[model samples]
Target: MSSDDDPPESDPSPHVTAVVLAAGRGERLRSELPKPLYSVCGRAMASYVLHALANAGVSRAVVVVPPDGRGRLIEQRLREDAPDLNLCFAVQQEPRGTADAVLAAKGQVHTTQVLVVNGDLPLLSAEQIRPVLCHDHNDAVIATAQVDDPAEMGRIVRDSQGRLVATVEYRDADPAERAIREVNLGLYVFRSDFLWNALEQIVAQTRTGEAYATDAIPCAVRNQSAIAVEVELPDGRLNVETPADAANAEAVIRHRIIDRLLDSGAHIRDRNAVWIDAQASVDEGAVIEPGSHIRGNATIAQGSSIGPNAIIEASTVGRNCNLESCTVRGSVLHDNVEVGPYSTIRPGCTIDSHAHIGTHAELKEAHIGEHVQIGHFSYIGDAEIGARTNIGAGAITCNFDGQSKQRTIIGEDAFIGSDTMLIAPVRIGNRARTGAGAVVNKNVPDGGNAVGHPARLTPSRRAHSTTGDEL
Candidate 1:
């Protein structure tokens, strides 16, 4: 990533196009949703693969999908999530093997080098891809991983002269072949010309009756044109096929997200308990406590401390803010704001700097100015309050009238006594005061005082309008 003043690299991106294989129907997972659309941690499974390609500097991609209604739904979501990437869709007309799936993307292939990736690998990273694409002279680059038990994988084959040869799947291999620890992860980078030529010569196996993409290795090797480069990834592939696999992949992604935050100097109290979504951002010096769920474009700025237990969704918290035991959604809290112990701030709310919302308070569609203090056990909805206003405990803004909602305006330096209820379409002027347990239904002019139920004007030092005139 370039700094603010750094000069941009002329072509920092690699000159390779990517084709993501996503036509697989994962019956093992036993879910109605498509495999590519399955939720992995906080995002769809295929989105991680697309992000890896983008981070690896692959500018354009073609995602292969089935020609079904589900594919259209997936396409809509992909466009919404990744609008910057130049995405094109290719329909795999039927259920086929890897080689046949690659052929579906024939029309979209334009670059000299092509990266073929499995869409199920949600844990794929750009660092794991660079080793394969970095080899300029290699005809093909295969990514392999080492596992303790190499079951249900293709073992890498070598010749007598210790040269790279082919990959033999465990189902078709003999005893010795299945023992090899290094297995193919079904990810490859290939030269465009060799990819097209080698895939055409593949013969379908009798067991599956499908043309395997692995057959390309032996074809290239037999021609004495195979230059295979292998990369052994440390994290391995997080491909999901079953329910258990989905849980494991979700755990891995959760760790990865938290680890990235820790590495960037964010303080998290308990690493295992917090759930930070894929797109959430926490600045340096921010603190995230245990049992917090941060999701959907949530950003915690520097010097902010959030939750021992809280949920923040699609909200922004400014610097030096503090929140605890609260849920905030689609709202903005400015600098030095203090919310919660137990509060719910809903959408379309703006809390200005130095405002304090005490415990058990809720605000929806409200604009609160600076230094305003709303005590505990209150509900303020569809209201606008000026700066330096002190709202008493158990206050309620009755802004809803069963048919339509209305707004209330409270001016600066106004003092409301405890348990006061301000009715809809009401205005309290600057320096106005309300008595305890007052049910206010009319506007009070500047320096006016209201008292009792269906409140009447109280005696004041300066004369003021008690005629409920709205400014």
Candidate 2:
């Protein structure tokens, strides 16, 4: 029979159900969060795997997560992040073997064949995944890797005819099996019925109290089923478990993102100085100075200038924003905002048009409106400054108490002097003024002025607030 006339060897509807095993606690990662939820290049580590599977024609998926609050959170996040992909969740109530995890999603596996992928392999791609699933075999077709050191991995034992016989674990393998360089990479494609039968046989072996997927391979081989090994591309298999592995995965992802950006018409003056992600966009006229790293879905609009030494991540910079020698992340800047030689714009900041963030200034979760000026050596966090406001040198909004956070609001056309400190949950109204070395703890009404450590109000001024407030 022709490939199409035969029973569906692979998913023909561009819809294969993927079983992603993410039930492990990943204790070696040493994080409170699950390893799959950890980031790689800008996205969750598991997201890359999901994307690859989706691209490889898996329309639906059942991610097997641990029975914990973290796992539920991961499922929710994946749903929100990749809404286009039809994804479901399956709970592995206990720490079981990989085969048990797959069986947890047995109800969801309706396709003729199922694609099983490891959650930790962040570098795997659709091109590599598709070929393994396309193999026409009555038995399981596993993606295998030829590693230099196969000491820890399960050995892929093949017969003289080069048909895969079994996968022997390192501890159980004989010397002859130990010499094989081909190792099971934990990615596989199996005929649905054969897989179900193998899993049933594996569960019957629970007398040992530990059920393993590798055990199923031997069962299939005993039944005279064909087990084949599909060699994977060298660059496709990277398993992240420990911190060192995470670091290596990060480097690999970084290189991939950089290469993709370069191919997409992004200019890097010095490869060492610049780190741009695959998803970030930089116009041709935009100049990314040396020692600048733009990461995590950030975009530098046309005519924008990034630092001689700056880092920007998970943020958006509009046209002509002068970001020189600063670190910005999870912030948004409108057009023509000037961030200076030494500044840190932390997460949740929104700097409006013509705002000036000067040298040594640090802002976190603050909103600086149009034409606002935040001068040197100031710290503004959890604050909202209105249009045409002026924040002087050495001024700080004390946002964090010993226990919690607070907010500071400066109204339109407000002028705050040097060495001023605004404590939490405070407000300065429109056109308010503060004298030099003022410590503001209370709200100042519009067209008012204040001075001293515990700031007091001054007489109203009809004239508009100018100078330090203007861009």
Candidate 3:
């Protein structure tokens, strides 16, 4: 079931291939993580660029990764994140420049054209790139953007006719060349045949003697085959090279998501403080309070109110539900469910409609039926509670007895009194009742009443107060 909330991985066309350069190890980010692995708005950096490639009708995507564990990690993530994009991982044997990375994907570059993109541009979107990919006049179209600081980025050089003449690399550019505001953003659409022919001509290396992709553009312009188009991206097409760059990129993405959510009818008390992952869904009329962190594939349906400091990851929240400061991970809550000002619902738990989980209650691998009420300070794990069951405050389902977990089953209309402990592998039948502070270890038959530690079951709904007999 694919929804708009999932990662934007569209089906690619069969005309052109995208060569994504992702082999760099981000030393500036100060983590052992490969640059492409850096997360922005809860998604890897490269996934956004690849999504743009797919959305722009690229035939396939060839991700260039380093040759090691980092490469495998990237490959695995790409496989999961953008499975719809016909993908191939090509290993760049060494940390190299943009030209070398493109060359590495030679095996998959069988199309008439190739779109070269930097993997770190987390703000890249398909709408910002449609024109460049659709340009068919020149042998290649260079993507240029105006930046406040052109530090270390290639400057787009244009001829008198306003056509692209060359891309002057920062390391080799003189004072006049360095003053250009329109700089190459490292995104290009090239004729595949021309690119192959030009790549072989790029023997000139940079100061560190690495093959330079920028150097190829000047020779290409001399052949009158290159044209540069300046496009203004809303987020300025940030190239995330350092930790600060990563932060800026995330800020831009956060604003984008928040604004889109607000426009889509999701209300947030404080948009700046909330962090909703790109893949998470907040339907129309959903109210998200400040300090809410919704991540992964979590979905909050219409009219639902979540958080003041809640964490929901990979969970489904049905319509009109109200959730306070709770942590729900990999759980499902049906319509009208009320969960906590402080509750934890762990993986594999499913609560049916109108179920109420009180403050500080926790549930794990529990199946709760409609109209069920779990009181405060209760722990229901590896359990199944039927419809209309009322679990009193401080109740505990002792599902794990030091060795392994066991099941506790409570039937329909059952009333579990306060502070009761239902031991492992136990069953309380329909309309059953448990006295306060009772510890029931054995099965209580239908309509039975349980009282005292190692509770003894009686025929009546409760024990006789004075006689204390099992009437």
Candidate 4:
């Protein structure tokens, strides 16, 4: 039962439902966004937990979202990104207690066993979750850790028979309990029926009218139900609820990603060249030069060369593409495409097969067709360039006019001369040619030649258009 698959019922298997508690208003974090939505290693922190759960074969999940606008955003993102994973959202109307949040999702979970997890733990992996689930207990099994200091944490209390008796909070615990080294890490596996019953009893009997999941442990123990403790791997637990903690989490996640990549045979030229949430495939002969950061699920194919200093993110580079000293984000480059010595290929830019972006060129939200050449010191934004076009040095598409951005289209075999400035919302047709130092602000017909500022066609040039040399 992987997180992406349906749970099964058998020995060494259990129909498990995950209840992720994400409703807390992290005052300590001091950010307007919900804590779970905060980024770690270029992805939302909660995504790590979701990935772990999915990998562990726990398919069904109930994310307890806060009763706020952020919760809706979380649901929307989850629907878009992880729709295949059985996801249901329950609202925590207020910051009451962790126990109450789980109770809110009672009706949605059908499995006999439930795994409660913290949404803010970014370092936890699926392997750590299996132990708690496999522990045979009729009542509950909690993941506890042996920390050097148990201050302000719930201390796990055990009986003479080594059964979990109760968890004593730091504020309420006696001196002996406070001295205990083992502390609850707020992860648990519980029988669904027992959990539901315990929640109901706590809500009814407690004077504060707020139920806590921790309070249910004593209730089960008082009834003489079997309760067990499972200690977690020392390095598996991480709490990232504050800015400091978030930084720490980032460092840990970065190191782990680097280790995973190195173990998988990827070379890291420089530790400072960050590869965040990137999936890269380098052929044995490919070289990733220094000062290049590849991030956001990008992939580099075989024989490709990237960076002396470049950045590629959320993009795909085809085989044998040469990307040196350039910055490419949210873009795609096809095979044999060459870019940079100093270039910016911004989001939504696509350079087709065999296209060349020469030195000091910048492109934003543009589409370059195959075999196109964009010369040095050119700015091509909000534009479309057809196949086999040649754009000269200093040619620019003036996309912005202080109010709105407009489009420019250059057709196949079009030649844009040096020092040419193409004002927005213009089109240059196939086989069209613009003379040197031309400022074109209007549409030019196919096979036509235009010259001068706010260019107009030269009549003599039109008659002998075919006689001119290819650009």
Candidate 5:
């Protein structure tokens, strides 16, 4: 990636356009979601392929989808997920062959060279694609890999003098041919002119009625118009076609994420136990304990300590914050915040700096100010507490009033005794105090005290008027 100060590269370094084949319906997985939309580490499977293309300096891509509701859904989701890439969609009207899928994207790509890859390969990386994109005079550069058990994969055919020849699908290959260790990885970079001509002439298989992209190789070899090269990838294509395949890909992605964090100075207690998603960010000097699952786009800043059993999903944890065995979902914790074990912070909660939330506390849609203390066994939902407030143990914000939820406002420096209940739509003024087991339904004025069931306020230093009064 070029830095902001660096000048962009000029032309002559071929601009390669990409065509992602994602129209297939993976029946083996037994799920209603499209194969390309399958989630691998909380992201769509095809997103990795597009990201790889973007990393390889390909700015534009055409994704081929089936012509149905699934295709429309895939287009919508991918567009929303990948806003960085310039993505265009093409509809494959029929479930023809892979070659036909590329044909569907014919006019969409306007570049001399084109890259074709399967969208189900969640492990696709920029390193594997760079060489193919850089290969200059080849009519077609096909990526191949040597695998232990090349089950149902196409085997790359070579001539007597070890020259590149045809590629045979597994079903069509004989026993001796099937024994070849090297299999087609289904990734190819092709010259646009040669690709268009070859794809036009390729024939469909008799059994499947689908035209294979591999047929283009023989066309190139037979015509002898352009040079075809094979680039063997070190790691084979890790495509997810089944549930087991998805799990394996997820494990690899998880390991990569953790390893990256470890290399970048983050401390991970257990590599195997901690599962951090690809989009999650754990900065240097952060510590992730065992059994922690950081999901979605959560960010843990420097000096933060997360888990021993915590789950943080789509949340942000600021510097020096400590989260124990709890679940923080769609919330934000500012600097120096401390959440005790077993606390559940739901969506729309924002905890300010230096605040401490006690164990077994649940907060939802609450805005907690700086240095606030929420005691154990408290439920602060639909409430806003000002700075330096102390919420007593077993305190409840009775927000739900049978029909609708209401708000509770607690002012700064206020102290509520243990087992106090503040009913909804109530306000406790600054420096106010509530006695133990008080059930407060009306607003308490500043510096006033409430001490009984259906609590009535005692005389205070300040007074409140019936009408709107400026004190």
Candidate 6:
């Protein structure tokens, strides 16, 4: 009843629990935030690994964190990002090593198999992780990749006829072992019993006094324990530790997201100039112009055209909408809305359908009704405009008078004149009219007319009939 590409109905390996190594203090990044909490494509870097584990059908996880302030922050962010996965935390008391980090999580992992992974890898995916989960017959399975340059990676050493020899770190390997091309990818799956026994036997390396996970492989070989080495291509194994690595990870993630958008019928003219976050959703038939950034769960509905230099964050843009050279944050624009160049829509603003916002207009905390027209160079804040209202050029809503912010309410079918200033706590009734340069400080009744500075209410003006008489 379903295609082969569809995800399975249940978890493939529910007996496998993941142990994520994240307690390391990354000093090379020179950031106050923890390395695992660093942002990659507008998401925490470690979230990718957790998502990969979920994709591989491993839902239960125990994240190992340092026993400090960094651990609390990492735990909180991971909980927010990957809430679907059943997760718990384990504290690594000291900066011992990867092996020690895994051992710290031993108490939390109750599954038959344990999946160990590094949290700094932002480019990891489900396809790369699923293969290691398949080889469950062996006591331990280590994922290996062949790279063009194995500069400082741990090498997978083998004896004559290519039998398993040992996993040697670059700092501790001989010349022959260093020349081997196959390197450890730092993704491993081990049986729970074998892992606990092997990790306990590993001694700290003399050079760094740290017990590396790579040392467990040699112990398995020496003890004649069944071990499997799964070979995969070098694609999504970038471990981000520095600024350069972070940039590379972001570029790879952006490319993948752009490719997905293109495949889903979205039009991106200049891919090189746009930066979209991983959480953004661009529907089919949407056109994204150059220099645009759609970030933080923003949604662009179908038939919408987003600009040649627009920054939309945490907003929703409806169908057939056009936004050009604007910055919209935390706002909602309904269908058939048109926002002109250099307009800024700040938080808590909602523009209804058929509304036309002219160039250089700024709105904040304002609720605009249907068919509303706001002309150029206007600033409307803390205001609510009714349907079919026409706000003229350079109109201002002086809602803040130094002490507190007040509200401006304009009724339906109102015509606000050019350069008009409506002072705080003012109300303009339905069908009311204001002359150019009027500064109104009081309320106007329905169908009334206000003119001149410190505007006073006057008699309603009637429309002229075809016979030259007032209607």
Report the lDDT tens digits of candidate 4 across residue range 1-471.
011212222234338899988887778899887887777766666767776777676788899998868889877755554523588899988777878899888989998898888888777776667678776456777878788866577788888877788888889999989999888877788888999998888877778866688888887788787455565656634667679878877777776666555555555676566544513334444556777766756777767888878887878888899999998889989999999798889999989999999999999999999999999999999999999999999999999989999999999999999989988878888999898899888777788899987787897655643423211
If scored against the real structure, what TM-score would every candidate get? 0.84, 0.83, 0.90, 0.88, 0.91, 0.89
Residues 1-471 of candidate 3 have per-residue lDDT tens digits of: 112232443434466788898998878888777889788888888887877776666658899999988899998987777835788889989766777888889887888878888888888777657668777656788888888878788788777878887788888798999998889887888888878778766744345646755556766687787888788866755688878888889888888888888878888899887999877889988989999999887999999999989999999999999999999999999999999888999999999999999999999999999999999999999999999999999999999889999999999999999999999888888888899999998877668889988898654544332332222
Which digits, one per residue and each the tens of the lDDT, describe model 6 over residues 1-471?
A: 100012323588898999999898789988888888898887887777887788778889999999878899999998877735788999999888888899899889889999999989888877778888887766777877778777787788767766667777889889988998888777888888888888887743336667866567766677666454655654544677779878888898888888888878999999999988877889989999999999877899999999999999989999999999999999999999999999999999999999999999999999999999999999999999999999999999999989999999999999999999999788887888888889988777667688878886654443311222111
Descending-TM-score candidate ranking: 5, 3, 6, 4, 1, 2
Candidate 4 vs. truth: CA RMSD?
Answer: 4.3
Off by over 4 Å in 2: 1-15, 27-33, 80-83, 222-229, 273-297, 398-408, 422-432, 439-471
Error of 4 at 151 (Å): 5.7
Distance (Å) between predicted and true CA of 337, model 6?
1.4
Residue 110's lDDT in candidate 2: 83
Q: Assess candidate 2 and give its lDDT.
A: 0.77
Error of 3 at 257 (Å): 1.4
Q: Residue 193 lDDT in model 2?
A: 83
Ten consecutive residues with minimal summed lDDT in candidate 3?
462-471
lDDT by residue (383-423, candidate 2, tens digit) is 99999999999998898778899999889998999889887
- Winner by TM-score: 5
- Give RMSD to native, each candidate: 4.1, 6.3, 4.0, 4.3, 3.6, 5.2
lDDT of each: 0.80, 0.77, 0.83, 0.78, 0.83, 0.83
* lDDT at residue 238 of model 4 (Cα atoms): 65
Candidate 2 lDDT at 109 equals: 76
Candidate 6 stretches greater than 4 Å from native:
1-10, 200-210, 226-230, 234-237, 459-471
TM-score winner between candidates 1 and 6:
6
Prediction 5 global C-alpha lDDT: 0.83
